[model samples]
Target: MPFFVPVGRRLSAALGLCLALLCLPAFAIDAAPADADPAPIALDARRATISLDGRSQQLLDPTGALGIDDIAAGPPGLNWRLRGAGERTVLSGQTALWLRFDVLMRDTQAHWELELARSGTDAITMYYRDAQGQWRVQRAGDRLAVSDWANPDRYPVFSLDVRPDETVRYWVRVEHARVPFSGVFQLHDHNTLREQRIHQQFVLGAYFGMALLLTVVALANMAVFRDAAFATYAIYISLLGLSMAASLGVGGQFLWPNLVRWNQEAEFVLLPLMGLVGLMFVRQVAQPRRIGRTLDRLCLALAAAWLIGIVWDQSLPSALSLQALSALGTLSMLTIAAMLGLAWRSGETWIRWFAVSMVPVLLASTLPVLRNFNLLSSNFLSQYGIVIAASIEAPLLFYALLMRSRIQHETQARAHALERTEPLTGLTHRPHFLLRLHDSLVRAQRYGHHSALLLVHLHNHAEIAARHGREVADRALVIAASQLRAVARDVDTAARLDDDSFALLIEGPVKPDQVLHTATSLLANGLRLSPRLPAGTTLRLRVVAALLPDADSELAQDAAAHLEWMRQGMLTLSEEPRKAILRLNF
Candidate 1:
């Protein structure tokens, strides 16, 4: 949020790219090798695309009308079709796309690995004849359980061995439900494949780690501040991380390899919940008063609707459910944007900060929506865009949250400070002073620190009020408080215990003689009044000192016992002349 202009420019460029991608149409690609009569194209360990065209690939019906013999024999006049013109193609419905390609090996000693880069495909099966001339099939995809895959890798991979100059035909069958399906194929040898896996893991692991850090920080803020906004944000970020893990295949590979059903259902469940919690966070940061009742109610209603939708989505048809969830996500985005706009117009600086923080996610979510409805092809950005965006957005939002939490903490501290203060004396009140004294005593007994307590009683306060007025007596008390504060050390806490009584908690290594000297000085200074008093007006003060135990001794448990003893000692000496200071050592 702090460098908004630069971030806005970057986001504009990214959003422009997303729009350009959305505007382009999916293309049909030709990745098939040359015919048998033509020269063979040798392939090494480098990655290469296996393109498919109307002539190279054919769509087969779900009824299995065309058998493997017909597909293998390369029969003429086959009903093959192309979805578009390029390497990428988007297909819908229940038919399997069979891609046939020839792999000519240049190095027979090296093994070639085939990888399907695109995820979200329902099922993929590759068919190739073995050395015994028997057709063997290798299966992989989200449609099947994780345990069913040939290898426990993140993507669908297959290994192939071929002799040099030998051309072999391979058939890959791909199928999906509801969503547009396209398989981006690549061939990598052992070393190349290993590097690819390592690179992919690094990218995903970094993103996941960033999300985890943000989640912990948000949860901590919630604990300290007791605010629902932080809690909602924590939930939203956690779902975002989980959704990425599921989409990027990290969840299936590591988190729940055996829970195949959860792997399949994670994205569906997490996306809606992210929307719900995200909207709740928005409503919390932008106070209801700022957004007004109508719009606020609308936000709450939308949140409830999403909650119901999450339940209904699981039960409804997959195609309908996907469409509904996509719609819900898009709607939530627009509504939150509008709410932020309203708050910004109303001059909410924190709202602007949040809006700035959301730029990456807003831009990243666009292509995924377009791809979901078959308007765009699945590519690098569309597949991992949200995850990448979250790596940046989470930290920025965390900064914004830190700012908000700091403001809240500072405000609460101010209110608490005021509540603990006495308005008349500008000092700690009786209740809060008792708490301070208790804490000090606890620390003194635990740490062996010397401590002293001083109690001052204005003996002439009532007499002064009867002679002059209550206002004059109040002025005399104020003057006495000033004198006590002037004599008290910086480490001591001076508090008003009652109308005419003041107490001091002196944390000390001071001797009992020093405490008695300070008490004598306070009683001598109490006669100093603010205004020039009438000719014969006078004031009297009785001050008492009690030295507490330096360690956890018997007197530590009865710290309050000395207060009554000091007061009784002062009362007993009230009749004696010039007995202004009383000392009770414990």
Candidate 2:
């Protein structure tokens, strides 16, 4: 859709050239016969001969044949035929000089032909549009239109055979590329009673299911990752797939019976919404900085617009706005692609790979967009692209998660190695106090039954270390551990929680006051902290404690609940940690 402006630009240029030619002076275009012989020349609009040439023995139009102009809004009967070339002339010539008189109008339609005289023999290899909206060749007699015969927009070719004096009524049928509704190929003839209905049901059910499932999965991942890119893209792709499928007629058949009116509006509305959401997704995924803020604004604005439109659901302008939204979304994609060029130049390999993933997704989805817009022919692939794209996209999400985990692991490794631990004192250095405390709480749950965390902050620790030197500081820490070990029950756990703060996990029924008193006594005076404690100094200690109600399997979960209490005071405890305790019935 973003690409369409250029197409329109080219169309404008072409229209200018056409008007120039149509209004200019009359002249004869040299007619080159297929066999190097000569053929009659038709009227040229520039020559001002609007009259038909009666010399070519023309074949009448088929009774049901609608001229290309009749379908489009210009010259109603401009789509006509030239007949009466001999069977030899039709078949023996290596190639025929066919003139395709394409009528450009709303979307557009085209018709033209070569005079082939004889009954059909070799297959007529003519290009047709598949449901996916790409141009492809089909056998003349092939059973077509499961996908509306979407021929690529190009010059026309006609092959026909006529018997001697026998009239051949070859039809040149053209329609605007089938506009996909809800991922379904448009239908031209639906008069069949049972057959069309059955096929309609099966196709609609299948595509709708695929689209719905895609939507759910995309939304689910968005919820999990909270990745704006993922959420935006998933919504876009799912809705695009859904809108495309519904537009195609096959999907909508289930919701609405074989009726003309109901299908039109639904297709119109979904097309733009899909484009809006999808473009937002691209901006996030691609991280095109230039487009990011703009896209973000567009998404917000479009969302509001859609809400308004939904309120006025009865309007066709709302439906047309979808096309505009789609164009806006396409702009986002182009912006991303441009940024990828920078991502490559910067040598960001991961971003580069991610950019690669988006290319295929865009190309695949584009076929359907082009089909829906009547810009390209039709095909059966409207829903298939989403399935393929989602498969590719799912892996990218996992890769992102893996990259995050790898980064986290490396950070933790560095922290573990760099942690400052006192080898002699077995006390954590100040630098590692927080990390050790966190790790201690994490590992202590195995035996922390009815556990109480006791934080003993020794007063005058620096003075003693300075007076006795490192030797006395070492001895004091060793002695402190030993004294605590002697008093601590076998069920209790102890750690020199910090350089000057030892932590005790008292089990069973120990009182907080008892722990505090013992901490003060063990840190006795003459604990000569640097001989600077004014000679006969006693150690003062402060204590903090946290009590747990039970030991539990989900101690981590419980720990999370108690984190706030731990942060608030010198001495803290919580009952939350015990809530996750598991009891064996045996």
Candidate 3:
């Protein structure tokens, strides 16, 4: 001011002052500062196990071009973000992902293992340094046969050794290009890891055992009853059990350990197959056509779609196939629900209970579908939900099948009764009587025993019907049937041979005299007055008896010809004045 500065100079002085003030904080900061490293995870006496979800750092390789050396170099461009707040690590659309973490051990010596808890990853490689300062690598995942993995197990496992106060660095690379990747990583000591694996296997064993038991029961029922529903149920459960095994990695680890391609493709194929068989089972049990023709056709179409989906899945990409199958599964569940609902509304009351039984399995099945679509993360429920629910569903479904079988048996028994018995007399009809007679005569011939056939003709049947109404004549026939049943032994067969004729087959071990006595009893009983008949009415009978298995006459060995011979004897006796009993020994 005292030097009389110009206006522009004054403004420039102010700007210089402002620039120095902004530069003061930058001058205070140190250049070449050390990189920020997160604190190492401690595995001490109190912390024997830990999950790496929130503690580990992850780097995504979009093109999967990075190698172990590039990851190990910690390039400035590689940004690793902490895997925070979630139990599962999920990365979509990336060809590979790298996980890095450091573990600090305070124990004297510790044997630890790192487990990637998901089973279906394409490939996984672990990079670390041994105590000898030499780089080491371990390989595991579905691309390689389970038998060839660094550790052959249901899940990929890597071993680690740390001394007291030693800090070890680890790098894990995951390659999952076919589908979205989701995994859980956990660090555990040797004993804890072993115990957990044993528990898991034990639980899986229980589930598979239950599935086997159910399948056996279904097959047994199918064999005994010859029900298509039971057979279909057995197939459905078997496929379902195998599908779950593949999904849980048990198939890869134990069933087809050396079949790397099949192990990867098994779940994709088995799920559709299981669904198809399940739909067929529903059709057998529900018989949806009973509800509506449209509903039935829809169910058939859905099942056919599942069959086609099996073929479609094989030709499509893995991710696309999974998505398609998930959609199909969801549609199948809905279709089943609709079919059951329509059936229930149409008065299939028993189907209500079946629908109730289906709820748990349908819900459980949806969990895996959700997982396949990446809508749900992998967990115990997602992994084993179907098995647990199937344990409940299997028993209930068996009960439903039993109910259905019983109903069918009862209906068939009623139909058979109607077909074999005379409706008016409630006695064996002509066809069934002939069948029994043929059997009895064959047995008598085989054992050289005596069997007798007694034939009675109601001589006054026409006269009585003419006098009274047909109703009174029916009462007389009923009386005759009751008398026949009362005189016949339990082992003997009482049958109505024709409109006015009745017959009693005395089974083997009978003397001729006994046959004569039986004929006499029948004549005497028919002669008695029945209160149910019209007043002053007596049943006059012409009785004929033939001992079966005549050695000389072939007619005696044949049921029809033997009965005709007895009828001829009755016709000959018709000419007699008196109602008489005729016994013929051939």
Candidate 4:
């Protein structure tokens, strides 16, 4: 029984380690391309060259190379053609020759015919490269022979004798076709037969996968933080994914075939867009650090420039404006400065990582700007910088968010727990009351505002407790706290200052008449504990308050000091009893 696996997409022929495991055989071997009939071919002894740029040469073996290998096991064809010197380097027939092509198709094969006529008809052998980067030479190539006679795979070792000044020509034809090889799965393509195709697919797939992940991460961050910066970054990632796909020619070829013409424009938008969002996110989180302010300003400028570039669709203008990435480099350098500042002011490790991640990418973004303006070559610096940077960046950002939230929420929970709780009534505590007072005082000082503070006492609260087991007195206090809480606004903080004495800070920047009216409403409740208190004890519960203009800083700044003054100036019992009120000038 033969075991097998499945491949998903196109595979490149980096070194002809062509082994694909069949999970379910794709019963169409005979359906090989109709034009596969080979034409008598001859080798042209010409080689392509690159001056400074380097070309990659890899090894070829069929079984397996590394764990990530997607090709199948067990040799099937004559794989001993040529062994290149890379990771899978294999030398065969002691030494051999190689065939290199730029773009290899799936439906095509490089068919070779080596002739021995000039060499005295010596028996010659054949070889090819396997999927595991190994060289496999076969002296028997007759299984699927399309020739009338079984082609000689190899000649005996000394079968060839050379005459002086005589040269013999050998014919080697390749019957190669584009066959998709993704994770042991095969598909059809007229162009998948090249070694480089596999490499390109892996690279493209990694980028697309990363872009998608970053996009998802950005959205999740935004939803949690509700910050525009995160949302902007998310949009940038999505655009970047599209942009990268387009730039790599994959989007035009497979995904968005119709949008081929928009490739440059997509690059234009995505390149700057990522920076725009990154700048915005940085400005928001890092704030006005020394370099941060500068970067933020630069981002703002780039956004404007991009908008302008979009409005006027000329390549040069578009090119010139993107030089803003030069600004990004300067800006990113400044970010380093800012990170130093932030580190000194607040020790956050994530800030350092963020700073480091920005450098290469910011530099990369600058490259395209230079290239677009003819300052450099378009071949090196690409629109894919952000995609790559973002690929590495998103995880760092998520870690940063975790760090930020971990510390932030811990501090927030502590402050809320300690400051806002009332000791006696478990209501808003003295600290919270003081905070509210300070805020109200500041507002009043700014606006010449008038506000009121009321001090309430359980009149004869000791006498009532003396008569009622003290439990009823506790009940009365509970009732009062509940009533005050029920009447409180979202801003109000009610606090118990002492036994039987509570302070109510009421914001009354309104007219003096409205202040008086609001006071009347509060006192009208009659403490509501009449039923909970002694029926005939006749202990009076009264509210004593003083209202002062908020601008009276000296009278309102210190809670104990100012409140003491207000208590001293408390109004006596008005004839209406509960309606007692007083108004003062700042």
lDDT winner: 3
lDDT of 2 by residue, 434-467 (tens): 4434454555555453445555555557777888
lDDT of 4 by residue, 70-142 (tens): 2223235423232111111122222322222121221123222222111111122333343455544433111
Candidate 3, residues 1-586: lDDT per residue as tens digits?
4876443244335434543443343234322222455578888767678888667888788778888888888888887877642323345555688888998877545678899877888889999988897888999988899999998999999987665678888999998754556667888888888999999999999889988998999989888877788888889989989998988899999999999899878877887888778777777777778756876787788877777777777876566766777788877776666665554554444666676577677767766665665455566666777888887887787887888887887888777897988988888999999999999988998898988889988888998999997998888888888888988999999999899999999998899888888778877888787878877898987788887887668675568988888889888888886748876773
What lDDT is obtained when candidate 3 is compared to the true structure? 0.79
**What would the TM-scores of all predictions be?**
0.72, 0.39, 0.76, 0.39
C-alpha lDDT (0 to 100) for residue 102 of candidate 3: 91
Top TM-score hit:
3
Q: List runs of model 3 lying over 4 Å from the truth.
A: 1-38, 45-48, 85-94, 107-110, 216-224, 303-312, 346-350, 409-427, 438-449, 454-491, 499-501, 511-586
Model 4 has an lDDT value of: 0.45
Error (Å) of candidate 1 at residue 95 is 1.7
lDDT of 2: 0.42
Return the lDDT, model 2, position 380. 35
Candidate 4, residue 65: Cα displacement in angstroms equals 50
Q: Rank by TM-score, descending?
A: 3, 1, 2, 4
Model 1 pairs whose backbones collide: 28-84, 28-85, 28-86, 29-86, 29-87, 30-51, 31-51, 31-52
Over 4 Å off, model 2? 1-214, 217-234, 284-330, 339-354, 368-376, 379-387, 394-499, 504-586
Which of candidates 1 and 4 is the stronger one according to TM-score?
1
Task: List lDDT for all candidates, in order.
Answer: 0.72, 0.42, 0.79, 0.45
**Ten contiguous residues minimizing lDDT sum, candidate 4:** 176-185
